[model samples]
Target chain A: MTEHTVKSFDDELTHLSNTISRMGGLAEAQLAGALQALANRDSDLAVRIAASDAQVDVLEQDVQHFTVRLLALRQPVAADLRHIVAALKIASELERIADYAANVAKRSLVLNQQPAVKPVGAVINLGRLVQTILKDIMDAYVEQDVAKAIGVWNRDEEVDDLYTGLFRELITYMMEDPRTITACTHLMFMAKNIERIGDHATNIAETLHFLVVGTPLKGARPKGPSVEAQ
Target chain B: MTEHTVKSFDDELTHLSNTISRMGGLAEAQLAGALQALANRDSDLAVRIAASDAQVDVLEQDVQHFTVRLLALRQPVAADLRHIVAALKIASELERIADYAANVAKRSLVLNQQPAVKPVGAVINLGRLVQTILKDIMDAYVEQDVAKAIGVWNRDEEVDDLYTGLFRELITYMMEDPRTITACTHLMFMAKNIERIGDHATNIAETLHFLVVGTPLKGARPKGPSVEAQ
Candidate 1:
């Protein structure tokens, strides 16, 4: 390729990465807002977070369109191809992360109507951990830093541990007082959603590993506790 | 391109679809076996179902390998491109569905240790419903039938309703007898896992719609009662 062609390709790649960054920013904000809304029992903020998911959805569609166009038009080989494919997968994962946040917000809308539960602080703290992991993974994508991505991947066990603890606490609360059952159940699902968000971050980390190394991550993915069995 | 090249391309497409079909079949069987194990309290079958998830993971990697190669090599446009992309997404969704089945089976291992809850039958029934939906969606994928896919998509509400009902029943059981709380809680998570499998099936249905019609399905995705809030 000529110098101009190489420059334009680089520009397109940068553009794609920028779009993902924007989506990531939106997802982070939405997640933070959702957690805050849950903590404060702010139904209106929760409603806004739910509505703002569409912005992320539109951004994801843009990423898809641009990535597919680059793949077909440029027909990039080797690392470039892997990069585009990873971006595609990462965009999808981010969109789903946004959806989980929105779902949490929606639950908050309902939970707001009930008396607040004691475990809300734990849920918010879990959300903070997941949001930080999400931010780190997106940065890893931008910087192509495998170490950072792996760091985020390893931290998922912390999220899972918190989820297990929260699960037991919620179950115990529900068992002790029948009145808290409905609210605690909602809290449990939100905690699970946050746990799932952590899983998606690990997925992005795996994709980044493949993109960088041109091979799948070796060995089994490290899992903490099985939420289902708990 | 020559006619022979086109023929070879078509052959590759067929091979790709066949891999997906095998994956789908394996996933279907895994879900069925998991539910059966849950019903029979057969920890051996449950253990096997858990072990079989690796098979689905291998198949998914195969699908991913073939898909990335096709995208880079053929540079298929329009419907062909969409078909390959949809196949990639569907394979991932199917693998996740298998994971959910495995998770349910794992939960069954714990639940089986205790005396069976009366609501175990309800969990199995919900699993059966999700399994049928999964099968229908797979058929929709094989046939590329958007209408059939939409039919399956519409039925997710039914799965959600059943899950909501089952959630309430499990909570009630736990409230009535503390002895049943451990078993019922595990069952609740298993039920939620099945519901999530239905959601993944719906995701495949939406991907099918995009593959066939070249546009996302319109309007909000149909959601039943919010599990968290209920």
Candidate 2:
């Protein structure tokens, strides 16, 4: 490619990456807003979470357009293709994570109007752990920090522990007082969504591993969380 | 382009599609086997489920190889490029679902020697739900059936319902008997993985929507089951 074209492609690629990061930033806020809605019992904020998801949707479309344009123009090979591919994946995961947050927000809308069925200690803790991993995974993506990615992978265990505990707690709530079933159900999905978000964070970590080392990390086969999720 | 190259390109595309479908078939079986292991409490089947996931990994690599090669060779543009891209995504999701099955199997291994804490109705139900959706999504991709794809998207609700019920039931068990926590936790993850497998299926449906119509479908958004997860 000529210098002019190279400059153009580089600019576009940079812009694309920045846009996704911006979208990621938005998604992070969406997640926070969702959780905040639940903790604070803000239905208005919950609705906002659902409404704001459209922004991530638009960003995803924009990123895909740019990625395709880059492919046709840049014809990026090897690692370059990997970068675009990874970006596309990151976008999807980020988008889905946003949806998950929205789901949480929506559930919070319903659960808020009802009484607090259980103390939600374990659920809240898992959310914190997942939020940290999400931040770390995205930071790793931006900084290309393989170490941070590994750290994020390791953090999944904590989420698993929390999820397991939360599961037990919710089941108890239902068995003890069937009246709490509806509220606890929403809370449980929130927990599940947070856990899944952690899984995606791990996925991002795996992508980073593949991108840097050209092989998945040893003994770290993407085993489902060793803890039982039932 | 020469007619010869066009013919070869079409052939290659067909092969790519067929290869992905074959991989989908394998993944479907793996998911089914994982559930079978759960329902029948067959450790051997669980081991087999774990072992069978390798084929998916191999097939995923193979699909990527062919996709990369096809991109290099034909440099397909417009709709052709979209088809190839969707194929890549479908392969990735199918592979992940296969991994989820392996995860389910691995969890079964953890619980294999333990006494049955509860009947496997909800987990098995969720697994079957996922398997059906997985198969339909593949059919959606192969046949380019947007309606069928949309159906897969809608069916995610059932899987969500099962997961919610499973979690609640498990939670009840745990609350009543904390001793069952470890084994039931494994079962829950297995169920959660199956639910996520449903999410991946919905992703395939979304991809098919994009491929067929050049846009994502509205609604059928991912969500946590509002009822309860544990």
Best by TM-score: 1
* Each model's chain A TM-score: 0.95, 0.93
TM-score of chain A of 1: 0.95
Residue pairs of candidate 1 with colliding backbone atoms: none
DockQ, candidate 1, comes to: 0.43
Docking quality band of candidate 2, CAPRI definitions: incorrect
Residue-level lDDT tens digits of model 1 in A1-230? 79999999999988888888898899899899999899888889998998898999999889887987887778898888887888888898899899889989998987877888888898898999898999999899889899998898888788888888888888787777777776777787788888888999899999999999888877677784363432
lDDT of 2 at B61: 86
- Candidate 2 scores a chain A TM-score of 0.93
Residues B7-60, candidate 1, lDDT per residue (tens digit)? 999999999889988999999999999999999999999889998999999999
Clashes of 2: 15
Q: What local lDDT score does residue A10 receive in model 2, on the 0 to 100 scale?
A: 73
Model 1, position A13: C-alpha lDDT score: 87
Candidate 1: where are CA atoms >4 Å away?
A213-220, A224-230, B213-220, B224-230
Q: Count the backbone clashes (under 3 Å) in each candidate.
A: 0, 15
